[model samples]
Target: MKLNYSVYLVTDREMAGECNLADIVVAAVSGGVSCVQIREKNLPTRQFVEEARGLVEHLRPLGIPLIVNDRVDVALACDADGVHLGQNDMHIKDARSLLGGQKIIGISAESLADARRAELEGADYIGISPVFATATKTDIAKPLGLGGVRIIRDNVQLPLVGIGGISAANAADVIQHGADGVAVVSAIIAAESPEASARELLQQVTSAKRIV
Candidate 1:
């Protein structure tokens, strides 16, 4: 599968407000989100599995990849396109051994060394996170400003997706700094119009990729 990391949406139920996750995902995809990561940190294993399965069913036909955040078991159970592992999550080698070569594996990197190690461990992509401080995730690391992003981009070969406090306003700068994509949480999901937010973000990402 050719991964287009252009506009990645990382789901947060609380941030989604009144809209159902499925509905939010469909709307985001319709507005041009290239990938969706189901990130339910508070849910129990059973509920997480169910959510992953439902998202997979919804995204599969649309040709969008469903990535289970920090849950290899959920990803395997749902037959999801991939899994996104945080720094403290399962080891990449173990994940690779379990998911095999076909499934996508992404790692969260907070520094250049983390990014380099992820690439060496065979991650399909690296999420360079906390580009700015974010309220959506409480356990965020130090914010990686655009300069940090450029430094990591210069050091890693894997596709870079900038996360944390990302919105349409800063999406272009993120990409211009060498992120192949931007992973947003609250910006789209919490917006009154998820689809329009996604569209605007996608437009910014597309325009940035072209110029950079």
Candidate 2:
């Protein structure tokens, strides 16, 4: 796992073709993204693998860790830096068995208990949030708000990233509560210029990171 990136960006398929996914990722990297997760849900496994392979090639040379969302098979096929698993995706142990040591694995945590469990199970890092509600999830967890963010900060020691509803406007508050970084999608992909948008958010995240 590279762990070279501090700003983590999750790609939504809506940005495909239109946004030049690879270019946006590179721009994000230039803007200070530490990691990129190629998250294209609903694509057939073969289609997903094809896309993941292209991303692996694009990111590998740049030295950025590319994480595939939900599918360990595709991750292995592309030799991705890691895989990010949701609560119901794949058990951490199984993923660990497959990826073996030296590969990164990230699990999502919505509560303190989930965060603790992820640590105990050998996850490399954890994604914690809906620090505020997000329209992304069909059935989302209760908003952690800042209090929940603080609880995770006090209870866990691993690298932490806050996801869901993160934007430049309130990103400072999220990292202020104790997230190592913020994972974003819409804020960059939806902007008029992804690279410029990412640079702005990266500035905010870096400033927030310094104070935290």
Candidate 3:
């Protein structure tokens, strides 16, 4: 799986539902979001598949890749640009086998070992953090800060996205810690203006830390 690291935006289904995922996504793209991930954890598989495809179709012309969270089946059915899998979801090898080599495959990791394992298994990139505790996920990982990022930057060769509790104000800190990009849900969704929030985050998270 090959993906160019850019602004990767993850979605919170509950919050997205309140304001309309399609609308926010469209607006976010217009506001300069380069990629989008549809992460609805509670929906029935079939229903989620349908929704993902709808999003893919809508974002296709705009050129932003749509990634389905955790479900490769849903991703395949939707012909999504890729899939983002958490630690417990599926092995990277098996995901590659199923999705083949061209589609994007992202793994969620917190520790250096996990990031290294993902890279060794052929993951395109890895999401690293809960740089801070986040309301987006129920079982959030402990905060990593710059120390956690340096560990992965030191040990793994894959691009990393610093996720969890990231907002425009703290985005510079994450990138400074070695994240290739920053991924957010609540920080953007909960903002008064989603588009402006996303744009600010994008503007803030510039320049990846030089991994030594």
Best by lDDT: 1
Per-residue lDDT, model 1, residue 24, is 91
Candidate 1, residue 31: the lDDT equals 96
- What are the per-residue Cα lDDT tens digits for candidate 3 across 60-146? 997788988899889889999889998999887888899888899999887877888889888888998677888777687678887
lDDT against true structure, model 3:
0.80
> 1 or 3: which has the higher TM-score?
1
- Tens digit per residue, CA lDDT, model 1, 64-135: 999999999999999999999999999999998999899999999999999999999999999998899999
By the TM-score metric, which is better: model 1 or model 2?
1
TM-score, cand. 3: 0.92
Question: Model 1: how far is 81 from its true place, Å?
Answer: 0.5
Candidate models: Cα lDDT each: 0.93, 0.85, 0.80
For model 2, give the 10-residue run with minimal summed lDDT: 1-10
- Order of candidates by TM-score, top first? 1, 2, 3
Query: How accurate locally is residue 116 in candidate 1, as Cα lDDT from 0 to 100?
Result: 98
TM-score of each: 0.98, 0.95, 0.92
